[model samples]
Target: MIDGAAKDVAQILGHIPALRRYARLLAGDAAAADDLVQDTLERACAKWSMWRPGTDLRAWLMTLMHNIFLNRVRDWRHDDGHAALEDAPEPAHEPMAHAPEMLDLHRALDRLTPALRSALLLVTVEEYTYAEAAEILQVPIGTIMSRLHRARETVRVLMEGPTDAQRTHPLHLVKR
Candidate 1:
């Protein structure tokens, strides 16, 4: 049998394509995706010895990649003097097939607190369970549920802004 280190290396190799696929989806830029994948690999290799065998390696690697991205963003913000975000030309906006509600939904998501947005995306977009998102975000399950509820409410309010204000008469709150 190969040594444990060798086995770990093989496992990482097997996971590279999946990692790249996920990174690509996350970054939306090919070069940035590759960088994210590389960052994840470097961190994973460094921590290989500590990784317990037969556990969920993919989730661990994904968590590591997420941290790598968050750290890079934190560093960029911290170094505003020399590493400011450049004024790149915006990509031309093409018409999407989304409904009016979708536009409001996207805007509301962008406007959400990062904690709430992240929780919502992890659970809804990425299809992670509330428990899995909680584990990944290092928050309690209750926090995930609260964030999900808040995110949905925010989106609904945004989508209904005009309609809500245009009502001719207010509905009674009484149960009669």
Candidate 2:
């Protein structure tokens, strides 16, 4: 039993970097991402005994982290003004010029509904399989596909600078 537990701990430690990257994508604030990962580790440690053997540890940890983030969002829902009004320290000394393409992508992402954004982050950024992402997001597989469809369309139109209405229709998707 001790050997099993030790192995599990090692497995969880290995997933930390991937978890941090996903949290950063979700929150867009490095400090907030670290906080979320810290909370996730604390939860994992406390609940380690509850984890069964022979299951996917990475997926389990990700699901826990996702729930933590959702709770934070729920708590912030009632707040009115933009919270956390501090400047992110610029990339030391020399920051890359703000590329127009990058700016538009960020703006388009900002417009996504939270559900769609989470799905895209999991699938595109984290490179999770559809099944794993659905499990983490706690959504049906079809829902993941549909959200990705809609989010992509919205981003495409926004990036291309407002194409014809026909192109904007979600049903008429032109997959990239």
Q: Can you give the TM-score per candidate against the true fold? A: 0.66, 0.79
Candidate 2 local lDDT, 1-176, one digit each (tens):
89977887789989999999988767766788899999999999999887767887888888888899889888788677645547535433323236778767766887887788888888898888888889988989999999989888788878886666764673755789
Q: Which one wins on TM-score? A: 2
**Local accuracy by lDDT, each model:** 0.74, 0.82
Model 2: what TM-score?
0.79
Clashing pairs in 1: none
The predictions' CA RMSDs to the true structure, in order, are 5.5, 4.9
Instruction: List ranges where model 2 is wrong by over 4 Å.
Output: 1-5, 80-97, 166-176
How far off is residue 24 in model 2, in Å? 0.5
